[model samples]
Target: MKRILFVLFCFAVTSSYSQNKISKNKKAIIASVEKHKQSLIKISDDIWALAETAFEEHQSSKILADYAESQGMTVERGVAGMPTAFVATYGSGKPVISVLGEFDALPGLSQKATPDKNPLKKGAPGHGCGHNMFGAASLGAAIAIKEQIEAGKIKGTVKFFGTPSEEKFFGKIWMVRAGLWDDVDVNISWHPSASIEADVQSSLALIDFKVEFFGQAAHASGDPWNGRSASDALELYTAGVNYYREHVKPTVRMHYHIQDGGQVVNVVPDYSRLWMRVRDTKRSGMLPVYERVMAMAEGAAILANVDYKVSLISGIYEVLPNREGGKIMQSNLELLGPIEYTDEEIAFGKGIQKATGKPEVGMDSKIKPLEPTREHPGGGSTDVGDVSWNVANINLGVTTAPKDTPWHSWAVVSCGGMSIGHKGMIYASKAMSMTMLDLFESPDLVDKVKKEYKERKGDEVYEAMIPDGPPPIDEVGN
Candidate 1:
C-alpha cells in the first residue's frame, strides 16, 4: 500500500513537471514565430506575386523547401510522384506533429492590394483563397516548433508538408497515397478566411472528372444531317447535371465548366470536353450521385449518336475533424486572444464590402466560442479532408479577408495582399505553434486524440478515391 502511494506521488510530480515544461515551450514558440514574421510575410507576398497555378508552382515550392533546408530541417522534395509536393522534418521518435502548407493560386483572379477591384494582370492567376498566406504561416509555426525542439524544451518530430495545387487539384491526395502521412500522429492545417475561428467542421467529398464527346465533323449548312455534333452530347450532359440538382439532397453541390463547344459556326467540331465537379457531405452519398451523372453522360452520348469518354481528374474525401484536437487548438487560439486591426485595415475592409454588395461590417476578428464538432454539412471541398481520415487532424481558419468577402475571387485576392491578411497570418502562426507545443508535452492528450480518431472512424476502412494513374500535373489551367 505504501509503495503504491509512493508511485502515485511520483506520477503526480512527473505530470506537474511536464505541464510546466509545456508552458515554457509555449512561450518560446510564440517568441520564435514573432521573430520570423517579417521573412514569412516576404515569402508569402513573393508567392502571391508569382501567382503560379496548380502542378506548376515551381518557384513557390522551391521557396518554402529552401527555407526549411536553411532552418536545418531535412527537406525532401518531389514526394508522392509530385514534383511540387515536398516535406520537411526535424527531430524524431513518437508523437509526430505535422503541419500542412499550400502554395497554389486560382486562375484569372489577378488583383492588386487596393480595396476596389484593381487587376494586377488581366486573366492571370492570383491568391484568391490565400494559400500564399497558408504556406507561409504554417511554415512559420513549424520553424517555431523547430526552435522548441532545438532548445530541448520539446522532443519528437516537427514536420512541414509543402502541399501544392490545393485550389484546383488536391495535391495531398497523392501525398497520402505515397504513405507520406503514415508516421504522422497528429496533423494541423489552417485556411485563410474572412473570420477567425477554430474550425470544427467537415468539408464535402468531391470528384472532378472530364467528359469528352466524340463525333463526326461536317459542314454546318451543307451536310448537317451527315455529322453527329459532339457539342450536342456535351450540352445534354450539362443540362442533365443541372436538372438533377433539384432531385439531390440540399447538401449536394454540382458544378461544371464547358471546355469546348465548336470551332466555328460553319463547321461542326469533332470533339468537345466538359469538366464536372460533384460534391456531397460524405463519400458514401457522393459515389451514387457521381455514378448517376456518369450514366447521364452515357445517355447523352447515345441520344446524340456520339461516343464519349469519362476520365477522373482528381478526388478528395471530407475532413474528419477531431474535436479533442480541435479543442486543443481552440484553447491555444483563445489564449492567443483576438487579433487587432488598424483603422486603415477596417476602412479597406469596408470598401471591399461595399463594392462587393455586402454589409460594411468591417472585419470579424473575435475569438468565437468553441463550436461543437459534429457531423455537419459544409460547402467547399479540400484535399486536407483526405489527410484527416489518415490521422487526427485540426482545422483552423483565420480572418485574412473582410466580413462576407467572397472566396476564390479578386476581392479576396486583394485583401490577402494587404495588411488585413498579413496580421491574420501571424496570428495563425502563433496559435498553431502553441498547439504543437501542447501536443509535444502531453502524451495523455495524444492518446486521447488517437483513441477518439479510432472510435470516430470506426471499422470503416479508408481508401483514396483517386485513379490508379499518377496525378495529372500537365493539366494545369485546364
Candidate 2:
C-alpha cells in the first residue's frame, strides 16, 4: 500500500514540474520576443544603412556585438580567424542551440527602396540577399531565448553566431575548421526568400578560385610582335573550359567572369585575371573535374606563352540532411503561423513585381507544411553545409522578396529595405523562438536529434574544404 502511494506521488510531482516549466517558458518567451521586435527592426535598419560586403562587415559586426553585450551575453570576437566573425553565448549547460546570422551584401546592387529600379549609388554595394533581416531575426531569437534563460524557465544554452562573408568568402567554413561548432548540439538558420519553408534537401559543394596570367607589354601599333598578350591567355582558358564542359558530369557547374582583360587595346595587355567557381553534388565528384579545369588553364597558358597562377579562394562541402531537426523546426513554424501581408505590403510587392516584369506573386495566402519527401536539392551554396556535417543543422526561408525576383538583384534589395521585409523578419524570429521553446520543453527530442546525427555521421569525419590558414577577410573589400 505504501509503495503504491509513493508511485502515485512521484507521478503527480513529475506532471506538475512539466506543466510549470511549460507555463514559465510560454510567459517568458512571449514577453521576450515582444520586447525584442523593436530592437530587431533597429538592427535591420542599421545593417541596411551600413551595406557592408562579405568578409568586410566591420560595421555590421560592431552592431551585433554591441547589442549582444547589452543583453549580458558572453561574446567572442574575431572568431575562426575572421575579423568580422564572432560568437555570442548565454546560459550555461548542454543541448546548446545556435542561431546563425549573416550580414553580407552583394556588389553592384545599389538601389533605392522604390518600385522603379533606381541605383542609390551607381556601382555601390547593396543587401540584395536580405541579410539585414537575416541578422536581425536571428538576433531576435537569441534575445528571446536569453530572456527565457534569465527567468529560470529554461536549462539549456543558446548561442548567436555572427557569420560574415556569405557573398564571397565562406565564413562558416573557417569557423567549422576552427572547431567553433564542436559544442553546439544543433544549428538553425533562415534566409530572405519569396516563400516560407523548412529546407529538407542538400546543397551543392562549391569552390572558388582565381586564374591570373602574366606577359610582356608592348605598343599595339608600334611593336605588336614584341608582346605576349595575357588577354589571349584568358580567352584561351575560357574556351578550354567551354570545351571541357561537354565531357564532364552533368551535375558539374562551372562559371567564370573576366576580372581583368587588359588595360587598353592600344597596348598589348601584360596581365589578365579570371574569377571562377566550380560546384558539384559531391566534393569527391567535384575534385576530378576541378583538376581537369586547372589542366585546361595550364594548357591555355602554355599555348599563349604567358605565365599563369591559380589561387584557390575558398571551398564548401555539401549539406547533409537532418530529418529530426527538420521536424522540430517545422512544428515551431506551424505554431508561428504564416506571414500575413497587409494590403499596403501586398500592393507594394505587386508593384515591384510589375516593374520587374515578373507576373507571379509567389507569396501564398496560407502557410505551407513540411513535405514528407525530399524531391529537389537546394540550388544554392552556403558555408552552413560545413556545419551540418559536424552537428544536426537545418535552415528555413521566409518570403521577403517578390516572386521570381532572383537573388542578388536590385528588386530584392528594394523590398528588403522596406516594411514588407520587416514583416518577414518578425515571422522568422517568432518561428525560431518557438522552435527553441519546443526544444526546451521536450528534452527527449534533443537526444533523438543527437542520436540521429551520430548515426548519419557514422565513421565519416568532417574535413574543412578550405585550407588551414587565416581567414580571407581581405577578400571582402575587393
Quick one: best TM-score, which candidate?
1
| Alpha carbon lDDT of each predicted model | 0.90, 0.83
lDDT of 1 by residue, 269-343 (tens): 779999899999998889999999999999999999999999988889998878888889888876776678889
TM-score, cand. 2: 0.92
Best by lDDT: 1
Per-prediction backbone clash count: 0, 0
Writing each residue's lDDT as its tens digit, candidate 2 over 140-204 gives 88889888888787788999999998888788888888888889987888888888787667788
Candidate 2 lDDT score at position 178: 85
Count steric clashes of candidate 1.
0
